[model samples]
Target: MCQEQKGFTLWFTGLPCSGKSAVADRVAEILRSRNLKVERLDGDIVRKSLCRDLGFSREHRNENIRRVTFVAKLLTRNGVAVLTSFISPYREIRDEARREIGEFIEVYVKCPLEVCMARDVKGMYQKAIKGEIKEFTGISDPYEEPLQPELVLETDKETLEESAQKVINCLKKLGYLDHNF
Candidate 1:
């Protein structure tokens, strides 16, 4: 197999409004600008396709993570950087993806629930409050944070540009990046 065949998957895990997807979007854009092949596999888009009718129960959440992990594995094996923004919410689920994907990099979009709710660009928190959505994350459900992520980002304290730069630096440090690659 070609050495370059081992591409990477940067999995962004956080609460619903915790800027996980936002940071992933910026990171993907920057990587593409550098001529690096990258694809973003976001939860909302994936769920709407493969898991549309799935509820917010823990089982459903785990299944969602599994589906994303499968896709990420395929993309990474095909030499494309895969950025997954999903509220994986469970350490076991995230760990399963790590073990399965092998080249996975976990980046925790760490932000307090209050901070995430305040940044609720989609008003999910407000709707959850009115019982419009049941078992919403960081509210009715629990989010098991990563114990030792390869990269941990405090999204609440940094701009999206800064956050993307942080991940880029991490990849460089890991020798997964080179100016001529």
Candidate 2:
């Protein structure tokens, strides 16, 4: 109803186990608690369902981001807050997304590669390092860090709540959250 609550896409980009989804989940939960319309598009789930045929190549990853951005734009147009977590490693593709979605906020989940490998719960980094997985971001593939973003959460140093709160605070500061709401 208010300008801040109107609709925007929160795009979280980072390495594979870099706490993007964790912060996204927390932010989504907090927004939902306020009875706001919200949806989260997770990379893993989207890969399995929406882009199952796509590989981990740069082209495929860019296409995946494009598809997700399209969906996020549509939802935002319909007055839904879209939260997306992905290893959107390329700045160009993320810039494309930002251009396509007018009300977009890019959140960079900053974590060191070593910390990501150590925090990998699924052992993806181990498998990637062992050559069992191909074209893995930060291992076999490259992850281009965001040149400039709305927020940078040091997931390696900050708690999940703190990271999520940072995003929320940014939204408020940017007038994305209506005070009256």
Provide the lDDT at 96 for model 1.
98
| Candidate 2 error regions (>4 Å) | 1-4
Error of 1 at 147 (Å): 0.2
lDDT of 1 by residue, 2-107 (tens): 3563499999998888888888999888888877889999988988898897877989889888888898899898999899999899999899999999998999
TM-score versus the correct structure, for each prediction: 0.94, 0.96
Give the runs in model 1 whose Cα sits over 4 Å from its true position: 1-5, 179-181
Model 2 residue 172 CA deviation (Å) reads: 0.2
For candidate 1, the lDDT comes to 0.88
In candidate 1, how many clashes are counted? 0
Clashes of each: 0, 1
Q: Say which candidate scores most in TM-score.
A: 2
Residue 22 alpha-carbon offset, candidate 1, angstroms: 1.0
